[model samples]
Target: MIVADGLEKTFWHRPNAKGVLGSFRALFSGVGSAKKAVESVSFAIEEGEFVGYLGPNGAGKSTTIKMLVGILHPSAGSVEVAGMSPQLQRREVAKKIGVVFGQRTQLWWDLPVRDSFEILQAMYQVDEKQYALAMERYDDLLELGSFINTPVRKLSLGQRMRADLAAALLHDPAILFLDEPTIGLDVVAKERIRGFLKEINRVERKTILLTTHDMDDIAELCQRIIVINHGKLVMDGSLSALREQIGLPTTCTVQFASTPQIQQIRGIERIETNGMQVQVFYDKRTISTPVILDEISKWGDPLDITLAEPEIEELIRRIY
Candidate 1:
């Protein structure tokens, strides 16, 4: 559904100085220096696939998305979405994709939520039957009926987000581009959006490409992850495979009744203790749960235990 070949984007940023003299210099010299934000990156996403694009701040993630969505032209290489070049047929491509930018709202602030959808229905040239269905479906999935008559600016953050999502899907696009759809949202709000996305991808067979800093979003929603760093493609694979490649450790924290200084157990690779709690790192392949539990019991009275998988951000940190 999406293909990018050797895609690249360079941005020229002018140095900013304090005074009018600096402004004059910038005027004469134009952009002071240039930096490559995306370089020789290429990948293909299949139809109905949920792919996560992950990177740190200013790590070319947004640059790649912009090029793929035709928001920004690439300096090098080619992009094709749904068999059409985004550069050549932006209008046609736009109709086939639903975009949700978490940091920005595409709806009119002063208008009622329904008005925004009405405007999009006209712009997308959707028929009354399709429009009514879209509204009914979004209202059902997003629970937008409560605030459908309210002005967009008066809605809560979560409500606004839901409304924006509904607006994006009004035309029933085949591909979805979600750029941090869960940002600044509480747990409940995030789960609501995630469930909606999962349903769209599963039930509707829509291709989805999601970019977010939240590891949980990626972990819960994406089966494949594409990692980028320093303007280059670093890793792209399944979440489990990426974790194995990066050597991200699984943490096992156990609380003991008393502090016990101890040597390494048969399965424990590393051990650290603070007060009455013991933290251990072990390879799941090398150590079974029964063995670890037996070793922990030998130390002292066991109070509690919690096992955690490494988050995506931690994995990215290790990769970079």
Candidate 2:
């Protein structure tokens, strides 16, 4: 439903001169440097797909999202959303997409949450029946009824986020652009938001593009992931594909009653032991978890154990 072909965005950085007159002269002079925020990035997102757009700080994830959403025009190449040019047909594209920024709110601060919905309803030209139905669905999913009458300024972060999600989907847009929708939210709040998004993507079939630093968000919500670094597309595929590409080891930390004799295991990459705790790292593709557990059991009596898959951060770090 979205395509970016050779998309690029460059921002100019101009430094002020020492004196006022020099500063004015610098403004007219070509004395600034160009920084490419996104470079030759290309990708296609199919309909009803939830894709995670990931990168570290200043990696151009936001820049790409802006171009796709028509907030910023790319310096090179082309973009299409739902078969229409977002740059040329911005108004029409706006009708087909919804956007939510974690650090910003589209709702009025002093107005009640209900007022914001009514305002957006009028702005989107939604009919009364459709509006009622949307509200009913959102209320059921988001539980907005608890704070519908409260002023937006008085609501908690979780409440505000839930309300914002409801407001964004009230128009029944075909796509959703979520930029760190779970950032700064508590664990409970984040889980709630994730659950709501999962339902929306499954039942409503809303194509979503999410940009987040949280690996759990990517793991739980996205089926595909697009990783970028230094303004260039580095990786694009499923999480399993990414792990395979990076060749990161799966680790199992075990707390035994005491230190036991460690032996050579074919698939085991390495082992670290500190007092009662021992951590074994291995390639999961080469050996199954049950086999690993059985091998470790022969070493000693286990008191506690925890298994962890390869982390997204580790993959991105290796890519960088």
Candidate 3:
């Protein structure tokens, strides 16, 4: 549904001059430093796919999204949405895509949420039946009815985000672009939004492109991941593939009744101990958790045990 082939975006920064005359001279000089925000990044997202675009700050994720949405034109290469060039067919591409930026809202700040939806419905030229259906579906999924009549400026951040998601989907676009959709939200609010997104992707088959720093969001929502660093594509594959590439170890922390003698075990990478507690690290691919637990039992009587899988953050750190 989305294709970015050798996509590149460069931003030029002009040096500031000390005086007005110098500034004017510098402006016309056409001499400035060029920074490539996105360089030769390539990826394709299929229809109904939930792809996570990941990178550290200044990693060119937002630049790529802007190019895909036709908000910013690419300096080099090309991007297509729904088999149409977004830059050349911006209006048609806009009709096929819905975008939600967490820090910005498309609604009128002083207007009620319902009014905002109505305005968007008109802008998208949605029919009455489709608008009603969208409202009903989003209301059920997003719980927008409670704050539907509330002014946007009066709503809380979570409420405003929910409203924004509803507004974006009101036209029933085939593709969704979400930039940090759950940022600054509490645990409950984030989960609510995640659930709503999951439902829509599953039942309605909406193609979603999500850019988020929250590892939990990637773990729970995205089926594929594309990682970028220094304006270049770093990795693109499934979550499991990323984990395997990084070879992140599984951890088992055990609280023993007394300190036990640590011994080398096959598949066990290393062991650390503090007082009565022992921490074991092992590659889960080489051995099972049950086997590790069983081996630990031979040394001492355990009081408590906790096992943790490698986190998505750790995997991403490895990529960066």
Candidate 4:
């Protein structure tokens, strides 16, 4: 459903001084410096696939998304969505994709949320029957009926985001480009958006290309992850496969009845402890979870145990 072949975006940033006068002078003077935000990054996403495009701040994730969505033209290579070039056939491609940018809303600020939906329906030239069904389906899925009459400017961040999601799907686009749809949202709000996304992808067979800093979002929604770093494609694989490829240690935290001395174990890399709790970082690829659990049990009477994947930052660092 989506393809990017050697896609690249190069931006020329002007040298600006600290204050207003210096910035004004520099704009008319020396040559600007060229920075490649996204360079030769390419990947193909299949129909009905949920893939995470993950990267750190200034990692060119947004640059790549913009090119794919036709918001920004690429400096090199090409991007196609639904077999149409987004840059060349932007209008035609727009009908095949839905986009949600978290910090920015496509809804009219002063108008009621219902009005924005109506406007988009007309712009898309949607049939009245299709419009009604879309509204009904999203109202049920997003629980947007409560604030449908409220002006978009009056809605909270969570409500505005939910409204944005509803607005994006009004035309029933086949692909979804979700750029941090859960940013600044509480856990409940995030979960609600995630559930809606999961349903749309599963029931409607929508292809999704997601870019987010949140690891929980990736874990819950995406089956495949395409990792990018420093304007280059670094890693791309299923979540489990990525873990195995990176070989990051699984963290096991155990609350013990007493501080227990942990001896060297084959798979266990390191161990740290507080008063009654022990934290161990171990490579599960080398040894089984059962083996590690058994060794921990032998240390002391365990009260509680929680196993977690390495932090996403740590995982990204492994690729670098």
Candidate 5:
């Protein structure tokens, strides 16, 4: 549903200086530096796909998102949303897309949350029947009725976020661009948003491109990932394939009654003994889980065991 080819963005700004005159002199002298926030990035996201656009700070993630949403024009490439060029046809593109930036709300600041929804409904020119259905669906999914009468500015962060989500979806857009949608939310609030996104993608066939620092968001919500660093594409594939490309080790933490002299096993990347616990990192592709369990049984009587996959950050860091 989204296509980007050789997409890039560059910002020209004067270098920092001690004073205004120094900055002015640098600017007038044509000495400003051009920083390429995104360079030659290319990727395609299909309909109903949830893709994570992941990277560290200053890694061009937001720049790429802005370009895709038509908030910023690209410097050297093209992007199309649902077969329409977002830059050339932003109004139509906006009609098909919904956006949520976690740090900001699109809702009117001083209006009641219900008023904001009404305003959006009118602005979108939604049919009365369709609007009613949308409101009913979102009120059930997002619990908007609880805070509908509250002012947007008076709602808590989580409440405001949920209200914003409802507002965004009131028009029944088919695509969503979520930039850190769970930022600053508590565990419960984050999970609520995650579940909502997953359901929206699965049941409604919505295409979502999410940019988040929280690895949990990527792990739980995204089916595929596109990682970038320093304005370049690093990885783009399934979550498992990305992890395998990075060679992330699967960990098994086993607790025994006592430490044992566990002989080294092939395919075991590393092993550590902490009193009554044995921590093992292994290559799952090389050795099966049964093999690891058997080896651990032989080492000592395992009282407890837990397995874990590598964190998303670990896989993203591989590009560095």
Candidate 6:
């Protein structure tokens, strides 16, 4: 559904200066350095595939998305969204894609939510039957009826998000670009959006590219991930493939009734002791939990046990 080859974007930054005249001079001279925000990035996404595009700040993720949506033209290489260049045929591409940014809303703030949908219906030239059908389906799936008449600016963050999602999908685009869609949302709100996204991708077969800082979002919603760092693609594969490649280090925190002698185990590594608890790091690929628990039982009576996987940030740091 999407293809990018050697895609790149560069920006010329204004020069820094001490005084007002110096600033004016710098601006006129265009003396600032040129920076490559996105460099030679290449990837292909198939229809109905949910891929997570992940990276830290200044990692070219937004740049790539903008290029894909025709908000910004690439400095080099080519991009084809559903077989047409977004730069050359933006209107056509826009008709095939829906974009949502967490920090921005496409809806008119002063308009009632219902009015916004009506406006979109005219803008997209949606027929009456299709518009009614879209509203019916969205009301059923997104619960839009609860605040359909409320002004968009008056809705809660979660409600606003749902309304925006509904607005984006009103045209029934073939692809969806969600940039930090779940950021700053409560757990319940996050889950609601996640469930909606999963259903849309599964039943509607919409190709989704989700960019998020929350690892849980990626883990739960995306089947595959494309990790980028320093303007380069570091990893791209199935979630399971990444876990296997990274060893999915599982940390077991076992609290005993008393501190036990720290002993070497066959499959555990990086074993450490802290007061009443013993922390053991082991690769799930090499050790089963039952065996590890059995070894712990041999040393002392356990008070509590918990296991955790490495955080997404730690995983990215490891890759870069």
Candidate 5 local lDDT, 147-206, one digit each (tens): 899888899899999998888888999899999899999999999989898889999999
State TM-scores per candidate: 0.87, 0.91, 0.94, 0.88, 0.93, 0.88
- Clashing residue pairs, backbone N/CA/C < 3 A, model 3: none
Q: Candidate 6 residues 1-320, lDDT tens each?
A: 99989998999998688899988888898577889988888999999999999988999999999999999999999999999999999889989999999988998999999999999989989899989898998888889898999998899999999998999999989999999999788999999999999999999999999999898898899899999887878899987777778875889999999878667899777788888899899998899988988888888889899988777667766776
Query: Compared with the true structure, what per-residue lDDT tens digits does model 1 show for residues 1-320?
Result: 99999999998888887689988888787768889999999999999999999988899998899999999999999999999988899999999999999999989999999898899999999999999998889899999999999999999999999999999999999999999999999999999999999999999999999999898898899989999998999998999998788766678899887776565787567888888888888877777767887877888788899988777777878887
Those runs of model 1 whose alpha carbons end farther than 4 Å from true positions after fitting are 16-31, 252-263, 272-279, 285-307
- Candidate 4 has a TM-score of 0.88
Clashes of each: 0, 0, 0, 0, 0, 0
Q: 1-320, model 3: which lDDT tens digit per residue? A: 99999999999999999899999999999999999999999999999999999999999988898999999999999999999999999999999999999989999999999999999999999999999999998898989889999999999999999999998898889999999999999999999999999998999899999999999999999999999999999999999888878889989999988878666788788998899899999998899998999899998889999998798988999889
C-alpha lDDT score of every prediction, in listed order: 0.90, 0.94, 0.93, 0.92, 0.90, 0.90
RMSD in Å for all candidates: 3.0, 2.3, 1.9, 3.1, 2.1, 2.8
What is the alpha-carbon lDDT of model 1 when measured against the actual structure? Answer: 0.90
What is candidate 3's local distance difference test score? 0.93
Cα shift from native, residue 245, model 6 (Å): 2.9
Candidate 2 versus truth, CA RMSD in Å, comes to: 2.3
Q: Distance (Å) between predicted and true CA of 107, model 5?
A: 0.6
Clash count, candidate 5: 0
Candidate 6 pairs with clashing backbones: none
Worst 10 residues of 3 by lDDT: 258-267
Residue range with the least summed lDDT across 10 consecutive positions in model 2: 258-267
